[model samples]
Target: MRRELPGLGSDPASVRQRIEGMEQILERMFVVPGINKPVGLDVILSLIPGVGTISAAALGSYIAWEARNLGMSKWQVARMAGNIGFDMLLGAIPVIGAIPDFFFRSNTRNLRIVRKHLDKKHPGSRTLDVQATPGA
Candidate 1:
């Protein structure tokens, strides 16, 4: 007799998988395709007038919620939100924004933030604690 949890329900792995998928979308589709010439879905979809960037940002925001479930700190969530905000704001600035989107991927940055925190909290993962040093 066990009560089921809410979001995660019964699988921690699914949460991890989802985060990984989002990271891939950010890295492969949004960032790397431009340099490598593979032509990702994100970039192709971004050809639309306004729907492209907005939809991508909405999709990326889910990672922030997932990061919270994974025990990420408020600062981490803020960083994720900031990344998405910048992606959206700058993404609206015509050609300049479009060019940056092909390189300066905020979703990837957010994913890295979540992964860094997860690895810190979970056992058997990389334990790199980031702390302020003396006289920096």
Candidate 2:
């Protein structure tokens, strides 16, 4: 039989780490030339022909689910949902939508909320940035 451990993966700090992982992939995986900021799978996926925004939003919902598990308030959770909603709604608009997706960065915004909640409730532990490749 396999056993799960406490204060490990399921704990608040671990949750923050996990959130960072998701945010790293979805929001900061790459860099654009000239502007010199990171971009991630969220924007790349948004560029897909169809079902892209939905798929990204679905992945985003996982963060909200994690927040609920972390005991965040209904308001905070709703705000996070609101962020995703805006991202998806705008992201659905085609060319113009993709442009905004490049800048909206909803995952980063949501992660900020999740990390703030964890940092407040679980003192001493700090939110850490996910490792990323250097952008050109």
Candidate 3:
């Protein structure tokens, strides 16, 4: 039997969920101890220098690729690519790179672009936000 991947469906809803999950993993997987700010693989991996930055870029590019598959305009995809490129440049810096990576959040930005496009063109794919009550 073949093992199926999660969120690999070609439907817009599946794509939206997939990209959202990726953005979450790349940009907000954990909270810093004292700072309490969320940080993800993008920031952590970027500390490894060349290979890490490239790996993050590749993962970021996957979002753009999904956008392209959804028939998003070339200009929009280009903008997403530009965001990733700029992020890679920042991550290339020594020591200080992760600091900027912590702030910039290219994957989150790309997710915003993708969400807007999906909301506008594929409204049915939109996911609702549900906040939990403090003591419920």
Candidate 4:
């Protein structure tokens, strides 16, 4: 029997959830001190010079890969790949790499692309956003 990993489903809904979760982990996992901005593994990993940038790029590429798997058009996939490539280049710079990586969230951009596609092509996968009431 083949074993399926959690969050690795092939359905559109599953894929949507998985990519959203990944984007959260890669782009909004933590809050920065003082500046009060959200950051995630993408920025944090890019701080380790060579290895970190590569690792972060690889993770970013996974989003593009998922986009391709969702039957997105070649142009969209290429755009996604371009986003990841540009991010990788930005991250390759030494000393100040993480600064731009913090602001330019390639994974978040890709997630937006993926969500657009899913919303149009797989409307059934649409999920409602629930926000908490202030001081409720």
Candidate 5:
């Protein structure tokens, strides 16, 4: 419905929408169970040599930017970065890395962190106001 954030009008709504879309992309593209054993995009792309893994890392960086925009602290951002770094490092090892990607779901983890921080910054920013009124 209405996605405004205080006085920011539609700007915050646009950002929120983008973040939600990105989260969906991460979840559907990498986290859902599939007929092919549910391997994630990170591992599947890693099979393409240098470019593939790098692309995955780039996507991770985009998530980091969104996290920052969502008011996530530097420490939290660092943790997400470390997770992606670890994914890249471990994903370098042939078949083992790919399998881990299927289970790791780093994108999903980062998405949750971003959503949490955003909600903390702007309560009810993305949901209906169903909580009891203070006077009621």
Candidate 6:
């Protein structure tokens, strides 16, 4: 089994970094020219036939799971799960889901929750870094 993150429940800096890295990849890894909006692996992956939507949704769940690991409240975790669920539901549809996927940005939404909760609970943990790389 994969090892639990060190100090995940009590100290979340390292865990936050790891989760933020993942959210960065999943939510906003690329920019649209001129329009300047960003997109990422989750949106790209959902465009694939079969497997893709499910995979993106599964990967999206990791943030919520990590939040639970950090001892976030059940309500907070449930909210995170709901965001992922909405993304997944929209993503499961072909063609129509694309625009919503671009706008909804559920991974980023969930990361904000994690950050908010961490800021309240962990106190000293650095702010969550969800910004996509420039020109990516």
In lDDT terms, how accurate is model 3?
0.92
**Per-residue alpha-carbon lDDT of candidate 4 for residues 1-136, written as tens digits (9 for 90 to 100):** 8877766779898899889888999999987899878899999888889999999989988888888889999999999889998999999998599999988999999999999999999999998866445588
Off by over 4 Å in 4: 1-6, 131-136
Question: All candidates: CA RMSD in angstroms?
Answer: 8.0, 3.4, 2.7, 2.4, 7.9, 4.3
The C-alpha local distance difference test score for the whole of candidate 6 amounts to: 0.83
Candidate achieving the largest lDDT: 3
- Give the residue spans of candidate 1 off by over 4 A: 1-12, 30-39, 124-136
lDDT-best of 2 and 4: 4
TM-score, candidate 1, is 0.71
Span of ten consecutive residues with least summed lDDT in model 2: 127-136
Model 3's number of clashes is 0
- Give the alpha-carbon lDDT of every model: 0.67, 0.83, 0.92, 0.90, 0.66, 0.83
Better of 1 and 6 by lDDT: 6
Cα TM-score per model: 0.71, 0.85, 0.91, 0.89, 0.69, 0.83
Give the per-residue lDDT digits (tens) of candidate 3, residues 18-135. 9998998999898899996889999998999799999999999999999999999999999999999999999999768999999999999999999999999999999996645558
Give the higher-TM-score candidate: 2 or 6.
2
Off by over 4 Å in 3: 1-6, 131-136
**Per-residue lDDT of candidate 2, residues 1-136 (tens digit):** 8565643467777787778788889888877899988888888778875599899899888889989998999999999999999999878887567789888988889998988887788975584444555682
- Tens digit of lDDT per residue, candidate 5, span 10-35? 34455566655554554345434465
Compared with the true structure, the alpha-carbon lDDT of candidate 1 equals: 0.67
Candidate 4 lDDT trough over 10 residues, lowest sum: 127-136
- Comparing 2 with 5 on TM-score, the higher-scoring candidate is 2
Best by TM-score: 3
lDDT of 1 by residue, 66-87 (tens): 8888777899899999998887
